[model samples]
Target: MRGKAAVVTGAAFGIGRATARLFAAEGAQLVLTDVDRDGLEVLREELAKTGAEIRTVVGDVSVAEDAREMIAAAVEDFGRIDTLVANAGIIPLQTVLETTPEDWDKVMAVDGRGMFLTCKYAIEEMLRSDGGGSIVCLSSISGLAGQSGQAAYGPAKFVATGLTKHLAVEWAARGIRINAVAPGTIRTERVRQLADEPGGPEYLEAIEKLHPMARLGEPEEVAAAILFLASDDASFITGAVLPVDGGYLAQ
Candidate 1:
């Protein structure tokens, strides 16, 4: 990834943060975007210690102008976009009965439309430069398999999963590779907070056992897989959804 210009949306924390660090270590110039300004600043400061060339865009991915600005930053600042990690998303664990119309819209806005807008603009930049690039979308196990309490989230991820394959086919002749990573339960900061909630510990324990590995995965673990898909290492691999799910999907 050395000398590559990469854009990672939702890059302030969790899988996005981990991916940014990994990308920097691999010597990629980065454009990181997220709604969390403070978190973005902290990440930028940390990466600066390593002399990583980075820019931050504090914006929501669901908004078209914001998505355009993010991709623009990469091209204007770095001169080209070599890869895009469309990692911006929101997960709402709710059943259809419990989900209100507003609830459903918010989830779809971030997880579904967010994926489309980011990919649409990023691919445009890639095509404009005539330098086809790689795109790694963040899908989830819910996108592949039916799960309890995924009424809203699962369908949104399905959008991500389907979009990945379609876009890959759309641009395959142009050298742009598009794929997705469907992760199982990962021990992100958000998940860690769950342990502090009532019944959260028991809930998580039960969830962990469902995985064949009987453990939650770390953000860095998923980040590694994202790196592989985003890099040339995954050349010739497109439209495939790789599961980073601790063998959960295997079962």
Candidate 2:
């Protein structure tokens, strides 16, 4: 990733944060974004200390203008967008009967529409530039398989999964690679919060056992997979939904 320019959405937390740090360490100039301004600033400062060229856009990825600006930042600040990690999302663990119309729309806005707008703009920019880029979308194990409590999130991720394949095929001849990583339950900040809820520990324990590995994955672990898909290491790979699950999908 040396000298490459990358954009990471949802960059203030979890897998996004880890990816930004890793990308910086690997010598990529970054445009990190998230709705969390304070968190984005803190990450920017941390990466700056390492001399990583960092710019930040604090906005919602679901908004078209904000999505465009993220891609614009890459081109404006670093000449071109070499990669994009479309990792911005919201998880709503609810049953179909329990999920309201509003709840479903909210999840779709970020996880589905957000993914679409980011990739749309990024691909447009890539087409305009001399070089084409790679895109890594954040799918989930719920996206790959049916799950009990992900009524809203599961379908949204299916958008991530489907979009990856469609775009990969659509743009492959044009030199832009698109793929997705469908992760099992990862121990991200959101999941940690769930662990503190009433009956949360028991709920998590039961969930953990469902994975063949009998454990939850770390954010860094998922980030590593994202890095591979975003980098030239995955040159021959496109339209593939790689699982970062702890053997959950295998089962």
Candidate 3:
């Protein structure tokens, strides 16, 4: 992806941050965005040390206008869009019966609609460019199956994976390739903090047992898959949801 232009949403921390760092290290010009302005600046400064060509957009992916401006900034800075990592999402851990309508909307807005808006604008730009670009979306293992406390989050990710398939087929002739990564429980800072709460360690232990590997995954592990899907290394891959799970979905 040397000299290529890439955009990553929810890039202030966790998997998004790792992806941004890896892409920059690989020589891609980057447009990193997040709702966390401070985190965005922190990451920007960190990347500065590498002398990478990067720009920061502190905006919410759930907003349509923000998504447009993000893609616009990438094109204005780097000439064309080559890669998109729609990694913006919020995981709400609530059972269906306990989840309120407002919660459903919140999860849909950030996790589902956010991906749509990003792809809508990015695809528009990709079609207008010389050759279409690659798009990698984040889907959770909860999306592939079902999880007790992920009623809202799981359904939204299911939509994400569906959107990936529908668009990949619709835009294939237009030269755009789209795919997704289904991650198991990743050991992000947020998850770790949550695990420290009362009864949290036991709850985490239960989750670990569910995975054959008896461990949670790392943000960088999933980021590696994101990078692959965004690169020409996955030239013939599209509409596929590659699992970055540590055998969680296998059994």
In model 2, state the lDDT of residue 101. 98
RMSD of 1: 0.7
Relative to the true structure, candidate 2 reaches a TM of 0.99
lDDT by residue for model 2 (1-251), tens: 99999999999999999999999999999999999999999999988999999999999989999999999999999999999999999997899999999999999999999999999999999999958789999999999999998999999999999999999999999899999999999999999998789878987999999989989999999999999998998999999999999999887
**Residue 116 lDDT (model 1):** 94
lDDT tens readout by residue for model 3, 1-251 = 79999999999999999999999999999999999999999999999999999999989888999999999989999999999999999987888999999999999999999999999999999988859889999998987998888889999999999999999999988779999999999988778987778877887889889989889999999999999999999999999999988999999
Estimate the Cα RMSD of every predicted model relative to the unseen true structure: 0.7, 0.7, 0.8
Which runs in model 3 stand beyond 4 Å of their true positions? Answer: none
What lDDT would each prediction earn against the true structure?
0.94, 0.94, 0.92
Decreasing lDDT order of the candidates = 2, 1, 3
Clashes of each: 0, 0, 0
TM-score of each: 0.99, 0.99, 0.98
User: For model 1, what is the error of residue 226's alpha carbon versus the real structure, in angstroms, after optimal superposition?
Assistant: 0.6
For model 1, the run of ten residues with the poorest summed lDDT:
86-95
Candidate 1 ranges beyond 4 A from true positions: none
